[model samples]
Target: MLQTESEINMFNASLKGKLENLSLSSFRDLTILNLSNNALHGTIPSHIGSLTKLGILDLSMNQFFGALPLLLGNLKKLTTIYIYEIGIAGTIPQVIGYLKNLLDLVLSNNFLTSSISLTIGNLTKLTSLYIHKNNISSSIPQEMELGNLKNLIDLHVSSNLLTGSIPPTIGNLTKLTSLYIHRNSISGSIPQEMGHLTNLIDLAMSYNLLSGSIPSTLGNLTKLTTLHMGENKVSSFILQELVSSNLQTSLIPPTIGNLTKLTSLYIHRNNISGSIPHEMGHLKNLT
Candidate 1:
């Protein structure tokens, strides 16, 4: 067989020049192993579980420290695992719940702390789960199970320290589209089943400690375009029923000029008063 495919491409170019000779026995038939951004330090070579046909494993921005590598769950055809800004600390490796064909699992800005492991709901073919700036705390592991992730799409667990609330089954992620649970310490309310996420478009729950009101069924997410519920303690008639449901474009409140396709409004500090809506000086895409 052409000299066994030229001895497996000269043994993967002599195991990429022995990676400065830390030699973990010549990476058995390696398959797509990028030593990401290299300054490669130690650990990570439980002989990489003998490479069982690895399918893309980036040791992200290295300085690679410890943990991670329960033989990488023996790489069951792993699909994209970038160990973000590596300096990999502990936890995160209940054998990566055996990789179940993972799809983009970037362990963001690592130094990984704890929580987050109900075996990651067995990965059911996950789709983009960046573990945002770790140091992870509790709440958000109610046995984890993301109803088979129906092809999940972009779910960043924002700056950790994660507390509770906001998981009304995450509206079962109906193919979620960008949902970042902001700076954690999360309290309750705001989960009227996330208005059933009608294919959301960027919904960030600001600096947690969330209180009640603000779910006028999220105006049924008319495909929201970035709706960040600022600082929390929600109310004001649920922000006037989310500006009478115009969904977004403007509506920071001058009674949201009845949302004539709002164009970016923030409603600073709160105790919002009256009188600014001269029909918002006629939209004209507000200043």
Candidate 2:
């Protein structure tokens, strides 16, 4: 229970029972509230919206139900929100764009449905956005405003029902180091613009309808250590222009030999033909 004039600005506990009785609203000065991994049941109390000073709110791994309240926009200072795996259903609210200070949004493994809100483009400061393993059934935004998140370093939207080809504008996220969009219904060829992500370390796009040959631009990602593009419609002649080796007629381009840092490469379950290039010997780090 909150005491009068309590100086506890941050609250984290496994307490059970409805949140309304906690009178969280009275703790006007609260900055962080975490009630995750508890037996707490009931809708997230609207009083949480009153905690304007809050910077982080975590209510994941509980029994909470119902949609996220639109009042959440009132928490203008919030930077991080973790509400995954609590069984919350409904589309992410459009008002969420109001949280200009938000830097991380983790809503994976939920029942969230429908398309992603275009308003998300307003959050230019976001660095990590994880919405994978959900029921979201929409094609990746074709306008590709997500490229506006210049600070984005991690983006995961795998294990959903997404479709459509990757937008060439995705190259605009030059700061990305990890990108995962596997296990979806996404089709079409890999965008040459993908070569722009030179900082990528992990790229997974398997178990989808992706077709066409692997873009040689991927060779530009010298920092990449993990690349999984299996179970797709990709053909032979992968990465033909990836290196200066200029070796042609090989199924797996010798240019692949240039990725010395590659540790895990999963290019199975495809229509690939010809012999595995001997150049693979260069990947001494492969495990």
Candidate 3:
């Protein structure tokens, strides 16, 4: 009966053992395979690629290790892939770009290394991408054309060795609600284009090599609630009034008062100094 089955779900089943003996290759018509939250351990089976009709694959919370099999690129119909926290190591394969139908791709909390693949631009349909909490290194290349993923809503690449300024093209992702690039080695001033993220609610860029004043444009994110910019080389203040003043006093910009919905604010370990702005009181929800 496995030959005719289209989906196999063993999520959180407490199943233990490698998939080598599961005979999954017999399921020719399978379209979905979920083996998450199990004790499955071993390199992902190479023959799993034979399931050409598969659309969604989840192996998260397993004990799988080693590089992703290149044959995964053959699963052209795949739309979602979740392999979070499975001890996978090695660079993300460029073959991932072959999955053009992908919408959500989560590969967080692994030992993956090397620069992000530039071929990711090919996944134009992607909406949410999580590759955080890994050892991925190198500057995010503008050539990566992150802007090409116009449908993106959540982008997380934090806690890595990433350097270089955030590509200005990120402003093109106007639909973004959460953007996290904190805990990396990124340098340069925050791009002014960030102001275009009017829909943003959570923005974190702390613990990096970022310098320069906070962009007044950030004040435009009226929906923002949590904003963290601590532990950086930011040398100036946000309020234009303070910026224009010849005095070195760095006051919290009154424009921050505009984000009335804000509840969490982290600005510690910067060069900011001066009297706290009374406008901060407008953030009645701040904690």
Candidate 4:
């Protein structure tokens, strides 16, 4: 029961409307509810799940639509569930696997279509899972029960419509460090067990329909600093924009110049070719 910051910035009106139900439900020992950047519309009131000592629920940037409320997963002392983008359409309510002390689940840009619910491997104390730009199409099921969410660390779903591949139990999230799935429609080839994610640092998959030949074991992700694999069907290219997407194949793994903390290297349109590897000039923190 603590409301300050100007009474939660007067329910932070970004302006839309709705959420009327709880006129603050007599603050039943309210734990912490932040009405994030609001344009709040309606729905969400499954009697606010009787706010059973709620831990932290942020109805993020709102224009809030429907679904999402399985009485807010029966509020089993939820541990931070952030509903981002507001326009939340439907699905995702596998009663949120009963919230088991959830760690930080951000539903990212919503309009949720459905399918991601494998009861999300029962959130083994999840560590940060963002649903990425939504419209969720499905796929990413679990090549090993989603590596049992071993204290996952930031797994952004990336732009939606997700198709498949990438779930080699996500190399069991060896304490993952930022792995954005990239614009969707995901295809195959990329699971060289993700080089066992040596504490990755931002590995965006890039536009979809992925093909093959690039994983020189991701140069073992030497704490990479942002590597967006670029458009797709990767193999061999020299697109000055488009020469019939000229295809052929291979090269570029000069052990990715041992990723000297790269500062963003978006591989360019795909197909890839030879010799630019002077150990990528030892990266000197490549911009």
TM-score of each: 0.33, 0.89, 0.92, 0.34
Model 4 clash number? 8
Where model 2 places Cα greater than 4 Å from the true spot, the runs are 1-12, 240-250, 269-276
Error of 1 at 167 (Å): 21
- lDDT, model 4: 0.74
Better of 2 and 3 by lDDT: 3
- Which one wins by lDDT: 1 or 2? 2
lDDT of 3 by residue, 1-287 (tens): 12238988888888888877689888878898998999999898888889899999999999988988888898999999999999999999998988999999999999999988888989999999999999999787574468888889999999999998888998988999999998999999878988999999888887888877667787789998877776676665555212221222356767867888888765543456777888888889977
lDDT of 2 by residue, 34-103 (tens): 7777778788777788988988788888877778889899999999988888888788898888898999
Model 1 CA deviation exceeding 4 Å by range:
1-20, 23-29, 32-54, 58-78, 82-102, 109-126, 134-151, 160-174, 184-215, 219-233, 238-287
Clashing residue pairs in candidate 3, if any? none
Clashes of each: 6, 0, 0, 8
Candidate 4: which pairs clash?
14-38, 16-39, 235-249, 235-271, 236-271, 236-272, 237-271, 237-272
RMSD to native, candidate 1: 15.1
**How does residue 206 of candidate 1 score in lDDT?**
79
- For candidate 3, the per-residue lDDT at 110 reads 96
Worst 10 residues of 2 by lDDT: 240-249
TM-score of 3: 0.92
lDDT of 1: 0.68
Q: How many backbone clashes does candidate 2 have?
A: 0
